[model samples]
Target: MPDEQGHPELEEIELGKVLAALADPARRRVIKQLLEDEAGAERHCTSFGLQLSKATRSHHFRVLREAGLIRQVDRGNSRMAQLRYGEIELRFPGLLELIRREKEEQASSET
Candidate 1:
């Protein structure tokens, strides 16, 4: 079932879509930023600091949103994105933990 915002319900979230969305480094970076953010704090898309062009960034966000990894809503003139943390955690336990660990490893490797 779809929520009012059109995002997938927790039980309806699919592993394939989620994994496909995270397969893109840019989308994973976006997810990592949201994971690091304070709980329930929606972030403006521009705040992600991605190097992609506006259109490309939009595409990445859209892919994530459609995959049920994140929820996007309009806040005034800007689009806000937030990880579906609790839902994702309950639906696929340890998945976010794995993503967080992966990001940490990548960050350390880049240093």
Candidate 2:
């Protein structure tokens, strides 16, 4: 069950890994941006606007991809990222919704 890009598939994406990936503030921000995008729309890596250095950004993307939360593809010279919403939903049902709701609550409380 390799991804199109040849990344090895997890026999089962562990809940712990998913939780750990989401635990990072930067990765959560990336997930939030992906959730805000229209379904099926891919965002180029540059469009993320993360303030981190290029290497750090790449590391974040790698974590998310390996965690099965995102699918990335190279478009020309740029990488495009999109949430693996449907696949994740199939695997973990309300997990993403719970994360989104928590993020929304946090944002509202800060203002």
Residue 111 error, candidate 2, Å: 18
Poorly placed runs, candidate 1 (over 4 Å)? 1-5, 104-111
User: For each candidate, what is the lDDT?
Assistant: 0.85, 0.79
- Candidate 2, residues 1-111, lDDT tens digits: the string is 657663435455767878999888677777888888888789987687678899999999998888888889888998899888888887889988877766554633442
TM-score of each: 0.87, 0.83
Model 2 local distance difference test score: 0.79
For model 1, residues 23-105, the per-residue Cα lDDT tens digits are: 87778888888988898889999998788799999889888988899999898898899899999998999998878878454
**Residue 66 displacement (Å), model 2:** 0.5
